[model samples]
Target: MGLYDRYLALRVRTTDAAVPEHVALVITERDLLEQGAYDTLRDFFAWAFEYGATDVTVYVSVLDRAAAPTLARELEDLDAPREVAVRQPDDVERADAPITVGIGLGGRSEFTAAIRDLATAVDDGDLDPDDVDETAIEDRLVFPNDPDLVIKTGAERLSDFMIWQSVYSELYFTDVNWRDFRERDYLRAIREYQDRNRRFGE
Candidate 1:
């Protein structure tokens, strides 16, 4: 780790409570299996629990069932890991483990916005609302926005993790890798979020 990273770690450790509920982790198949990286995930869950997160979801795309067994086994070993469930967009509703929805996206954007747009069109009479069911319309809509702050680390650019939900979320990116993630870094991010003046179109 660099001196700056070490500095951030120190700051996070000294910070106060700032964790929010409803945490979602977006991980590619390559990051989990190919990268042989499960420790970062374990750490994230551990920290999320420590922060008092009631609901936590792990979002995955392009999954291989063969890899699921090993990952599930590892997750089963942890105390809070059992609370974490794997999901695809189609099966998000069936998720019983603390509402951990797996949002699947076959199109260009994440499903949430598309669903909202589609529903709005139906509501606006632009499309036939009778064709879609009430539950289906509700699923596509990303209402009750729970995301307040989203931290994208290791990569300077924002990945398509919570593209729809994070439309107005405070974004903080770091070059630090997942393995090096520490409590202090998390705290600093929260502190930064606290300091921001959110202007949601006035």
Candidate 2:
């Protein structure tokens, strides 16, 4: 670690506030196409775990569906700190790894798929329409784990990620692009999250 990185880490460690256990990052497919993007991702995972995050979810939004396979392959091959499970938009199974990379899976499509599954269960007499609750919907979600904090780089908008799960998560938006993202950026997000008084919608 560099001197500035060490200083940032020290600040985070000394903070009395709680660190987010589950962290989510929202980036675009174009972001990964940039140079050093994969290296940044590797460092990001290490930094998150070092700071207190146990689970890290990465949502890669792709404008073209044709690019999904290529993006998934590249992300899956990334040298990360933990196991990575890369899934496409239509994937029904839940990701079981510590790090999950969703390629071209928008939050709206994920929710729609979950609803469709719930409807199927209802139609098959397996689940009553009235009995279907939040738990049922969550059970059908591909990535059901809720994150404590969500980070979005290069923009303030959440690129259609974790709609159901990130309902109560603290969001941190940075103008820095993914390739330019450094340890300091991660620490800044952590510090921002730590300083927030999370109400979880009261």
Candidate 3:
């Protein structure tokens, strides 16, 4: 067996958990930028598309200095059909395929900052109560969407991954680092997710 297969075998044998039918992965731009692996992100997203991902949303926080527009532009330039999209807050367009790629403005920040920004805008008269019809300051910040499961591999801390969307998402953490993340490790995480009862605030 290949090394990855071996790891999968071990996990499956040891972990008596079930596998989830649908799965979504959230990767931080820090990891991608640090490794200079924009291609890796592209490949992973393409794979996810082929893997029957009903919906795929990739958020590029303007707040991240490492993932600057230069790098994003370079990566977007190399791709074939331009499956990747560069979108601002108001430019969201619906698509045909179940899988879609979108860019948003914010990441794992407490809505505290967002609230404060909106308040500042209101107080400074940049935005009036009547002027806030369709466009509002809150529209710029990215909020986490609740996923059925969230898996964080590598590193001990939460890494400010998903603050809002993961409120009820089942979290499965592993010491396995990102570089070493193999298919088996992912399968194991899925199995772990399947085992959860997920009462979901009942």
**lDDT score for residue 109 of model 1:** 46
- Candidate 2 deviant stretches above 4 angstroms: none
Best by lDDT: 2
* Candidate 1 TM-score over all chains jointly: 0.59
Better of 1 and 3 by lDDT: 1
Query: How many clashes (backbone N, Cα, C below 3 Å) per candidate?
Result: 3, 0, 1
- lDDT by residue (1-202, candidate 3, tens digit) is 4877576556555665543323345454555555535555555455434333434444444454544556456545746323544433343332223222333333334344555667787899887767653245336444323456565655544544446545666777788655556556655665666567887777
- Weakest 10 consecutive residues of candidate 2 by summed lDDT: 88-97
TM-score of each: 0.59, 0.96, 0.55
lDDT of 3: 0.51
Off by over 4 Å in 3: 1-30, 33-43, 46-52, 57-67, 74-144
- Per-residue lDDT tens digits for candidate 1, residues 1-202, read 5777577555544656455565555555555553435666666666666655666665444455455545545555544554645444433233456534343432234465456667788889987876676455445533323456666656655444655455666677766665566666665665676567776546
lDDT of each: 0.55, 0.90, 0.51
Ranking by TM-score: 2, 1, 3
Poorest lDDT segment (10 consecutive residues) of candidate 1: 99-108
